[model samples]
Target: MNNLIDELTPEEIAAGDVAITSELVPWHFPMMNDNVRNDAYEKALKAALKNGGTVLDIGSGSGLLSMMAARHGASHITTCDFVEMVAEKAKIITARNGFADKIQVINKLSTTLVPGTDFPERADILVTEIFDNGLLGEHALVAIEHARKHLLKPNAQLIPCGARVYAMCIESSEIYKNHRVETISGFDLSAFNQFSSYEYSGYHIEKSEHKALSKIASIFEFDFLKDTKDESVEITFEVTESGLCHAVVYWYELQLDKDTIISTAPYLPQLSCWKQAVQLLPKPMNLTKGETLKLVAHHDNEAIWFNRL
Candidate 1:
């Protein structure tokens, strides 16, 4: 009789290997924001301790959050990640912390993990720190929605119950010139313009506090338990000051509650994977200095992709 837990297929092994070895150790795409995680962990632990039930940590990058939940008196802890290497490392870390018996690590995506089927049961508390800089970059919403529908108990508590995308215009000639200008010193290197189109590059904001160039835009929202509707949230921004809108500067603000919120904007002096998702105009729009850029943010809930128009 072969138990499901002991059955590790070749496909699962390959996926795990690629995610852990490549994503977790050296090139962590969604870099851990320790401050955010620490804050969320403390809050979740308090909630979990009060409830005193099993916990599930999704996207368990290094098993730190799961371990915290276990130590905080969660009846049991289950951690899952799509990346194999990260899961392998997390297993080691969990075992090393003497929680091997109490905590289980599964190398699978949250969407595929079923409660009572793949896991012991529906976790009472679901804790995942999969947020990106502006709550749009990581698959946080997708993972949360999937878990809530399939793996979480009816009354399960979701850490970071909801999140918002906060963004405002900034004046950064340095970043614009860096991306917009193609040739310099008599070189015809226009072919290098492709890098500017890629949205992965993190930008530098000089000031720690920023005045609203326009009102802040709310790109998306996620309430873990409810059915998430699909519709593009349209926010139009009139460029008051006419510099190149190299891209819309983006960041994230988390609503722990009505009173407690954690904001990780570029001006906040914190490092996070939710870097700026810039949508540079295909052609640089030269405003007469006061021309409004009229930026429209388009969000697709299914694929979890956000783009500016």
Candidate 2:
């Protein structure tokens, strides 16, 4: 996302107008609106439509993927999203791209859709951008589970066919400050850490900010096309540097197709819609270069928190 905080006036930020305007206009973020995401989608969609049939785009935001499917010679495309306003906007977007006849935008959850009524038939291909920071946080498991059981063809091609979350142990006092509330002007308020959220944050950790103590480790993986179950993951990584480790710096890789992959890993050139997400340690731990750190992930609903086993 662009650095709007620096551009906006202090009054706008204080009045919450900056946030309000952000929601009012979602198309401004270059992270999602630019060619980085679209290029990956185009390549994968073209490959999927080599022998095209009906394409189903779950969470088809702004109808871009549907238009891409239409361009790739799909017989028909049914794009669906739960948001009514977004669905309506998709209709207008599809029309502007001159795929109004080939694509239909439906405003309903994927689970509610039925064959022979809402859609003419089960989808031959399932294309969706349903992953979150941890790869499962956006109800992707439930959505894919429902689709495999009811909506998709027996052998449908699932775009972003799989994903894997990679994490590294890091020691960053600067990063910890965001979540930790210590004394401010001589008041002991460390108890506020109990109320601090463990949710993955969209924090941009610069290269200079954090010191990596361990090699990157893959914590979790999901294969969307196959029968899958969500579960917590445990990982152990050998520390490469000695330091005070404070957080798990994490990101995910998207398998758009067999031949294509997109990611938001640190220092990568082509990034996806997601920034890297971090899971802060409850307490800092000192470590050595040769020692290992064991990480146990606790998953509830779709969120994850990493801690010592």
Candidate 3:
């Protein structure tokens, strides 16, 4: 047997070729290990495939979702991933799992796929899990929009029909330190703060020492079945506790189906593979209880950000 890892030079390994087989690996295992996420998706797939129909899976990492659809009696499944390595691996995985004949793996982006060329015809169901920590960071909106127009049949069922995003102000020195640098070892290292990420950063809110300064409020909602565009929305939140507001923490409720929902909210009893997103403020604001704070949330179909108003 040929060993693939042995073919790579030491330089290639150091260059992240072997260390990171695919950018998908970081989250792939976590997602596969998440019983809550897996169960919810399995349940949704069963419900959608109860009647047996052709399914199109976008961003089908490891072909897990596609296999799930197959297990639930999908007549056939066409799954695609942008990463060539991921697609190749999925093909082998599906074949080994006895789904080689039921599922077809394509190495291309869903947006680039042609209906007849990619598959025999438009699929009757669309299932995908292309969300990032902040929901839109994986270009999910763009992919779903394109797939709905060119790949899926009219009124095709979406695994996750819609999603609602929620946000809340928080006071957390631990989370703030990850983004802002002030002084270290009596030296002013604040100059490096310019490199801090303006976009939302991922963090496990339940694991971090933090306090909720304001009530969590729904800020945005997206329907995967409909066309969407870049949007900006301003939301006002009333402070419930007096403290230094260092960041705005956000999570999403993923509506896998009418009855299946999974959330990344910190209060949830189980920890999900997806972490809550934290948008650090330029500077911490001393908030007073009963005061209202306004912030604008913007999404450009890919990235999301927040700005104080």
Candidate 4:
């Protein structure tokens, strides 16, 4: 959100501690404060490290996961972050936490990591939390696939073994107004809507008033330990409530292990760091009960989107 940076006062921006481009600072705080997310990763790390092995942590913000691996008795840990500032802070954090001997922080992308040069050898465990609201928007598929092939040992354990994305059609003029520009105050402002995004945008669905028009539909599944490619598929949902479909709201369940799952479902009581993604349709479609809504769900290995068919 550029507004987060734009809202900063001149004095604050001039402060030595402030980073103008550090929009990620706001994100890191919420994620680190999320007990559900932190606890699940800790549990997964403990389970994955039961046999004792080295770990490779991608997107190591603050080096928290890497430190967790070290605490779980991982023999060695190598972590990386593409952001130079975050990587530097992670190194400082690891050292201050007394894990400097066990964890190595790299200021480079995981995609650029080379075995035997970046670290002693391929790691026996891979732990990472690089997902966005849409799951694939941060290129988790590309990074994980590359790690599996070049940075991890054969049969290496994955903290989040996989994930499944789900979507449901919704009717909410309140939400639609954010993306659509129509007649306002007797003036036609609809022409400005040409700049509106057709792609999905993240929102805290719990804070938004909306009515579900269709049952949730499973759209895609990804296995972190396996190689994957860009994919597109047609998914159909049966309308349960007769209403105008304004957008497709989507969320995901992250499978840390077979038994450990963290969900961003709007119905869940706990708030998640990752918000639900909403893809507003170009035009609202009126539907009756029992009608079928077909959507083409596609991911380009980085971002995800849905289109009415």
Off by over 4 Å in 4: 1-24
Reference-based lDDT, each prediction: 0.65, 0.80, 0.88, 0.88
Candidate 1 structure quality by residue, lDDT tens digits, 180-257? 666689987777777654443455454322233544565666665676666566566655665544445766666654
Give candidate 3 regions above 4 Å deviation. Answer: 1-24
Candidate 1 — worst ten consecutive residues by lDDT sum? Answer: 18-27
Q: How do all the candidates rank in terms of lDDT, highest first?
A: 3, 4, 2, 1
| Per-residue accuracy of model 2 over 59-161 as CA lDDT, tens digit each | 8777888998999999999889887666776787788679989998999999899988998899898888866656677788778878887888898888878
1 or 3, which is superior by lDDT? 3
Q: Measured by C-alpha RMSD in angstroms, how accurate is candidate 1? A: 6.9
Q: Please count the clashing residue pairs in each candidate, in the order shown.
A: 6, 0, 0, 0
Tens digits of per-residue lDDT for model 4, 111-198: 9999999889999998889999988888888889889999999988887889999999999898899889899999999899899988
In Å, residue 245's CA in model 3 sits off its true spot by 0.7
lDDT of candidate 3 at residue 280, scale 0 to 100: 92
lDDT of 3 by residue, 1-309 (tens): 137668754544443445554455788889888999999999999999889999999987889999999999998999999887678778877987999999999999999999888788999999898998999989888888888888989989998999999999999999889789898999999889899877888888889999999988889998888888789999998999999999999999999999999998887788999999999999899999999999998888887788977
Clashing pairs in 3: none
Taking all chains together, the TM-score of candidate 1 against the true structure is: 0.77
**In candidate 4, which residue pairs clash?**
none
